[model samples]
Structures are given as C-alpha cells and as structure tokens.
Target: MRLLLVEDDEHVAAALLAVLKRHGFTAGLARNGAEAIEKTQAGGFDVVLLDLGLPDADGFEVYGQIRRLSRIPVIMVTARADVRSRIHGLNLGADDYVVKPYDTGELLARIHAVSRRAALDQASSDGPASGGTGGAPAPGGQVLTAGPVTVELSTRRVLVDGARVELTRKEFDLLALLAQRPGVVFRREQIISDVWRTSWEGTGRTLEVHVASLRSKLRRPELVETVRGVGYRLAVPPAL
Candidate 1:
C-alpha cells in the first residue's frame, strides 16, 4: 500500500518510515503541510498520516485542502491529546486520530482500518448498481429520505428541507449508515465495526459524539432515538 507520512519531526518520521516500509508500504514523507498538499495533488497515495503542528500550516488546514481535491482517507497524527483537538481533527474529515507517543502497532491497525474503509468506498463507487453502469443499482445506492432530511448515497450529501447541510466526513458516514436502515437499532459496537471496519475498544463515545453532531446538523434532534442499554435507531420507517 502507498501511504503519505506528513510529520516535521525527523526522528519520529524516520522511525515511522521504517515501520511502514517493514510492513510493505511504499511510504512517502512530507516534512510540512505545504509539501503534503503538493504531494497529494500529485496523486497515488492510498492514505495520509498528517501531523497537526506543521511548520507551514495546521493539519486541519491541510485536511480541508485535501478534502477539496479528493476523498482520500487521512489519519491525523499529533501530540495534542485534548478532546477538542481530536474532535476538530475528525470533524475536518480525518478518518482517525492518533496522539503522539502512540504505539506503532496501534497505528498500523488504524492504517489497516482506514485502508479497508477506503477500499469499501472505492468498491461502492465502482458498483454498477450504484449507477456505475451495466449492472443493477447498489444496495447502498438507494436514496434515504426521512421527513425534511434527504441523503443521497452516491454523493454522500445530506440535505435538510432542501437546504444542503454541512457535515464532517465521519458525521456524514455515520448518519448515512443509520439512515440506510431506519428503525433498525444498531449497537455502538456494530456501528464501530461497520462504519469504521474495526473492533471497538470501549470507545463507543466516539460514535455518540458523531451521532450528536449529525442530529445537530440535521436540525431534528429527535430523528435519532437512543435506546437505553442498547444503541441508536433512526426514527424513519423502513419502507420509506
């Protein structure tokens, strides 16, 4: 797999580069956000490891630039451990966030998880059923409508009452997953595994945070109901 590693710390970069190479990744290194942006535009990277405290720009800014250009998966690697930082990174379209001093093995796991999701996204994009031509519509291609909310599966766009709603990538994915199965209760574990394609490590609150953000953006807090002791379900009818 090809990966981009954007970090200004030489020592950390060297260590991570070796680890990634040892795991059969053709890793490219960028010392700053500017280079990261430049390299990304050059294409061919399957994933990006971004550091927030870049010399030229913040990681979030880099993330915005990348999102404007492509839907490539990004994992933020930063020393900041605050909840606000993590939330901000994820809200800016990062697939995941790893704090500095993280375990290399855990980082590898995250890379694998994000890579799997990217592959799924590509597969969904190429599925003939999703208007890819020459086949039936993809199961994921069905448009979801609930009251004033309209979610277009192919484009991953969420519209509320005809107005486009701005949502972070994670929020959009989470909302789409729930809306795809209205009234079908999904446990937090299931959501983590399905949406993130990874095992839950007692970090279900991340799902809750994204769900809350989705509700806020949808402007209908009651759209998603929390089942006590279980999980969450979209209030829309299944047949809708």
Candidate 2:
C-alpha cells in the first residue's frame, strides 16, 4: 500500500521507512505540516502515519487541513500516551492511533486494518440507493432498529428518535455490532476481535471509552448494559 509518513525526526523516519519498505509498502516522508498537507492534496496515498510533533505546525492542525483535502485514512503515531490526547485524535476522525515505542507487528496490523476499513466504507458510499429513493442502500446490509434508534449500515448513518446522531467510526461499529444482536452479551475479547480486529493490551480500555462515548451521544445510558465481570450488551428497548 502507498503510505504517507509525516514525522520531522530524520532518524525516526529513516528507521520506520526501512521497516515499511521491508514490509512491501511504498511510503513517502513529510518532515512538517505544510509538506504533509501538500502531499495529501496531491492524493495518491492510501493511509497517513501522522506524528504530533511537527517542526513547522501542530499535528492536529495539519490533520484538519488534510481532512479538508482528502478522505485518506490517517493513523496517529506519536509518544503522547495520555487518554486526553488519544481521545482528541480519535475525535478528529482519525482512523487509529499508535503510541510511540510501539511494536512493529502491531503497527503493521493497524495499517492494514485501517486501510481495509476505508475500502469497505468507500464501497458502501459508492453503492446504489435503496427503494429507488435518493437514500443510501445496502444490498447485504441491514437497517437495525431498537426503540427510537435506527442504524443504516449502508450509509453509516444513525438516527435517535428521528434526530440524526453523529458518531465516530469506532463508535458506530461498536453500536452496530451490538445492535445486530440486542440483549446478547458480547465478550470483551470477542468485541475487540470483531471490531478492532487486533489483539492488543490497550484495546479493552479503548472499548470502554467507546461505550461511554456511545451512551453519551445516544443520550441513553441504559441503552448499553455492562454485565458484572463480563463484557457488555445492548439493552432491548421497551415497545412504545
């Protein structure tokens, strides 16, 4: 896959580029935010490995600019391990985040996962609409409903009480997985395997954070129930 590596440190960039090349990936390097934006505008890369420590500008600002330019998947690779920073990056619509001192195996796995997701999302978007209307359609996708909440997999849209609810990619994936089998408790490991598609130490916490975010955005804390010493399950809503 073609990847854009945005890092100001030459040493770090060199080491990473070598590893990436060995893995059969064609990668281009960008030392600063402006160059990153310029490359993103040119639009040939499949994914971007963005570092927060940019010599010219803030990485977050660069990320915003790149988003405005292209829909290429971006994975934040930095040393900022704090929850606040990670959440901020994810909130900015990043495909994933990898803290520094990371394992090469995990990094490669994340890259593949992000790229796969982007491809699927793109395919869904380019697909035909349902019912001869202008709305998105899912040939094999299902429209799941629980109470006042509706999830359209084809368009990746969510509606709560007839009001649109904006959700991050991960949030939507978590919700959709549970919505598919309401009241069925999904094991923590199982959830991670299915949603994140990677086995990592931080995935459990990430799942908890995503669940919290989903509850807050859906404005229904009771919608998702956490089983003691178990994982979680989507609560079946009462009939209106």
Candidate 3:
C-alpha cells in the first residue's frame, strides 16, 4: 500500500520512511503541511501519516484541506498527547493519532487495521445493488433485527421494538455500519473512517466515546460488544 508521511523532523521522517518501506509500503515524504496537502492531492495514497506541527501551516489546517478534497485515511503523528489536542484533531476529522516516541509495532498494527476497515467499507458500498424503484423485494433492504432494536437503512431510521429512537448523525452512521454486518469486528480507525468519513488521526477513544453515546440511546446496549484489543461488533442474540 502507498502512504504519505508528513513530518518536518528529518531524522524522524527518515526513520519512519525506512520502517514503512520495510513493511512493503510505498512511502512519500513531505516536510511541511502545505507540501503534505499538495502531495496528498496529487498522489493516490492508501493512507497518510501527518504531523500536527508544521512550518508552513498548522497540522489541523492541513487536515482540513485534505478532508475537503478526499476521504483518504489519515493517521496523525504528533508530540502533543493532551486530551484537548486529541479531541480537537478528532473533531476536525482526523482518523487516528499517535504521540511521538510511539512503538513501531503499534503504528504498523494501526495502519493495517485502518486499511482493512477501509476495504470492508468499500466492499459494503459496492456490494449488491441497494437503491432502486419499486420492483421485486430488494435484499439490500434487509433490516438488522436484534431483539427490541430494528434499523431500517431504506428509511435512514432506527426503532426500538417499533418505537423510533432519536440519534445524532454520527451515532446513526456508526450504528448503520455495525448493523450492516452483525458479528463482524470493526476497529476504531475503521469506524471513524467508514462512519465519520475522516482519516485516522490517532484517536481510538473517539470510537468509545461515540459508542457510549450510542449505547445510552439503545434499547439493548449489549447489542454492541467490545472485542477486547480489536474493536466492536454487533452481538447476535440467541435464536427464539
């Protein structure tokens, strides 16, 4: 897979480039936010590893620019580890974030996880024909029925045992992604990209935060199961 690495520190960039190359990734380097945005738009990279501190522009500004043009997955690599910075990055549509001095193994794992999730989402989007006028019943109209909960994609609505359940846009999107393939695990990075349409800016907690909000509104909170060390999946209840 091709990846864009944006960092001003020469040593850091060199080290990461070698590591990413060793992992069979075609890595592109950018020294500043402006170059990062430019290279990103010009190249078809599978993912982007961006640094928040850039000489030309703030990392957030670069993120905003990239998000405006493409939905390419992004992973933020920054020295800032504070909660506020992380949350702000996420709010601006970053997919994941990795603090400086991070382990190479962890970063590689994150990249693979995000990539896999992207592939799954693309498959789902391109799978069977979903939208069409009245005709034979469409299989894409399959409603995920989980006990008291029912999600209807055709109507973009959710109901708990027949009663409508109010949800924010992000919450609804997250639920729909999970309900699309019950029991299939989705990493936090995948959830953020597929549901939020943002690159991974290194904030996996965003998934937990949103999931907590979703569970609070769900009739059966247990329907969404946390798959320790992986991500989350919709639980399949016992047959009646």
lDDT scores for all predictions?
A: 0.78, 0.83, 0.77
Better of 1 and 3 by TM-score: 1
Give the per-residue lDDT of model 3 (tens digit) for 92-149.
8777888888988668767765665665555456445555323222244345565566
Better of 2 and 3 by TM-score: 2
Best by TM-score: 2
Model 1, residue 191: distance off in Å is 18
In model 1, the worst 10-residue window by lDDT is 129-138
Sort order, TM-score high to low: 2, 1, 3
User: What is the lDDT, from 0 to 100, of the residue 133 in candidate 3?
Assistant: 25
Candidate 2 residues lying further than 4 Å off, grouped into runs, are: 130-240
Model 1, 28-118: lDDT tens digits are 9999988999999999998999888998887788889988887889999888999999998888778999998898767876776677567
Candidate 2 lDDT over 44-86, as tens digits, reads: 8999999999988988999999999998999998899999999
Q: What value of lDDT does candidate 2 attain over all alpha carbons?
A: 0.83
How high a TM-score does candidate 1 get? Answer: 0.56
**Which pairs of residues collide in candidate 2?**
none
Worst lDDT run of 10 residues, candidate 3, spans 132-141
